[model samples]
Target: MASNRPAPQAPFAPDASEPFAYGAPRAEDGVWEEWNPTEESLPAVRGRHRVAKQRGGGLARSSTVLGVGVIAAVGAGGMASANTGKPPVSIALPDLPSVDSLIDGHHHTETPAASLSGVATATATAVGDSTADAGEALRSRIMAQAERQQSKADSRATAAAVAKADQQAAEAAAKAAKEASVKAAAAKEKAEADAEKKAEQARLAALAKQYTLPTSSYTITSTFGQAGSMWSSGYHTGLDFAAPTGTLIKAIHSGTITEAGWAGAYGYRTILTLDDGTELWFCHQSSISVSAGQKVSTGEVIGRVGATGNVTGPHLHLEVHPGGQPTGIDPGAWLRGKGLTP
Candidate 1:
């Protein structure tokens, strides 16, 4: 490379009398002749010269520059090797001034080590910042994913809780509805029973106005169809009312007296024939108050109870015969059919 330093001045030449001095002209064989030095006449100097000069600090400055260049090159190579994962690259340094030029007071400009170091520092800083940014982004993504998972778990728990609550509410409502239904059915059944009982009472009241008992203060001593030897038939075919002698007997219903007189085994008997042709016979009476062909209203006095013929005590025997049949029917059942109990 071309150097920016000024050319060095030549040294002073000695007189011809000086014996063979360098770069000085000398007379040959004592004959006085003029001589001049040329570029071809000087021999070439080899290698770096270590000569010190008074004007410039020679070897010390060169050593300093050399050390700085070597350090700069090592830094650049090491950085390049580390980044590329390869062998260090060779770095070409700027040519430095030789010792001869330095001793001649010639200076050369060199590249600064600070500039290379600055470039390396800037590149490393950029790589470090990039790595930091990447790590931050990854951490942010992980945190966001964790939050989403937690939110999903919470939603599931809430849904389960709501469903359970709804089920409980539904069950409670169903139970309440079932209970209400049962209560309504029971109320309906009770109301129907009460209404039927009231109707029966009303019917009995109406029948009471149409019929009356045969006698008062009497006890049922015998029922009809009772088997005994005391009766003419194999079974008793009449109802017997036991009472004190002379107790008054009343007509069971509005009827006409068909017969009233003393009978062979029935003592004083009275036969009352209803308008429907049903006959009610009152036997074993102490006295008869109605005569044949006489019309009597219900509850009218008819006869008195007595222990007459074939009687066990003071009782009035009664028989019912529909359409004047020869065989009699049960008198107690016949009385109940008229809304009366015997």
Candidate 2:
């Protein structure tokens, strides 16, 4: 629609080289009007300069809002990158869904320019939420790792204690076994000693019943191996018992009388031969009661004491010849070994 308004044009420099200029505006019928500056219009000029700021806070405020929007967009981009596993861009502008549509589960068809403010707010909130969630997950993982390490340490300590106890128990068992073995050995040794003592006593008891003495009512006159001038050998080889002239002299053991005759020096000597081939001689007897080849029992009278054959008085000489050899052993020691005290 055409109206009676002015057409705006470039300012005209009235003088060619002058810095002063003025607007050349034409009405619809093509008429020019004069314009000039004055102190009276100074307030009007200042008002014209502030017109855009009064309308919408001017370019500075718009730049501040745009900067805040850009910051919000970058934060939202970081959150989106974390959520979607993508890299973030250096400058990002957000495309936000409307809160109303999201709350109602409905789609809002909006123009990009119309929804910019709401998208920036939602992007900041999403960035904050994602950061909080990641912090919480990291804290949980660290706490779990600490708990597992503590459990492993506790298990190692418990195992060490158990192993120590087992080693001590094994050592104790070994010590007890050693002590028991020592005690058992001592007991066995003692038992063997007692058994040996009892066996010796039993042997002596049986031997006491089998032997007898050579004479009765007699006093020991001479010991064996005594140096004397009356003896033919260098030492007297027989034990002598001084008795009455007619005293009875008994056989020392069960034996056969091998000889009952006069010997030149040991007159009226009688020899008794035992089953084990040992010979006993009873000499200087007043009279012989047993004949040769006669078997005589122990304690039976075999001869009488006489003062004959290299004797100072009436005495019986007793000699022992082991294995029927001619060499005589000491008779007093042999008699005492058969349980006789003399």
Candidate 3:
């Protein structure tokens, strides 16, 4: 029974390593908890401890500020080195070709076939685009040239048409002028011809007023101044104008009335005595227009012829005397001297 009894009284002494005993109660909390932690177990609960409220909060904030300061310092150092134009800090070529080893190797004589192939492809593309651009430029130039040529041709045609029209107009005007001149000349000639014809008609009328004849168609049947026993004066002294009965008779000269009556030997007689005392006897008249003492003038129809006297046929016995003598001279020569043929 004595061996089985629990012993009591271990003195209360603090251990350096172990701050709290496993079964002892803490003085401040009355709970059994470990105060000191081990190195291996420290990582698990390094941030779990607490102090005073203000001190712990300041300590946590100071740790966060230190971490930010460290990161800013490293960024500032890198920027300063870059601005100073320094080389890279580390060189780790992952994909770049090692030109150094190739230069140290054997002299490799070969064509740059791969590089040439790339250059050729690029040059061919450039040449193809250049050709297409040149072709477009040439076509544009050709179209412009053609337009210019067409414009020139149209101008020439217009000029030619204008010239031709001018020539035609000139020709028409000249023709009209020539025709007018010809018409003027023809009108002047016709006027001259008409003047000449009128002058000739005036001359013929003046001549008709001067000469006279008794009958239109007559013959000299007997003559005056013949020594024969044929007249009452024992000689032929009158000119006989033998014509058909009823033939027209005219006065030989302008005179006044003497006798217009029938005589025995001179049938149907008309005697006209002129102002100069020359007596003209007209016989063998069919009628008489004047009385025995009626006055007469030139061209007066005094009598007409008839066979009422001692005549064998129808005739006009005419006699001209100087002073109304019974016998007359040759009247043919006398009338011919006064611009009359009969």
lDDT-best of 2 and 3: 2
Candidate 2, 1-342: lDDT as tens digits: 888888887454455443233234436547644456465765654544553322222333544566576666667677777777564344434554444344332344433643444555556556656766786798899999999999999999999999999999999999999999999999999999889877856765565567777767889878999997778787899988888999888887898999999998998999999989999999988899989999988788998889878778999889999998889898888877776755
TM-score for each prediction?
0.51, 0.46, 0.37
Candidate closer to the true structure by TM-score (higher is better), 1 or 2: 1
Residue-level lDDT of model 1, residues 5-56, one tens digit each, is: 9978765745555534334433544555546656578676578965333344
In model 3, which range of ten residues has the least summed lDDT? 88-97
Model 3 per-residue lDDT tens digits across residues 71-186: 44444544444455342132111222223224332332333334334443444444444555665788899999999999999999999999999999999999988898888888
Candidate 3 residue-wise lDDT at 251:
70
- Runs off by more than 4 Å, candidate 3: 1-208, 227-229
User: Residue 261 CA error for candidate 1 (Å)?
Assistant: 5.5
Off by over 4 Å in 2: 1-207, 217-246, 264-267, 310-315, 329-340
The number of the candidate with the highest lDDT is: 1
Model 1 / residue 179 / CA error / Å: 2.7
Better of 2 and 3 by TM-score: 2
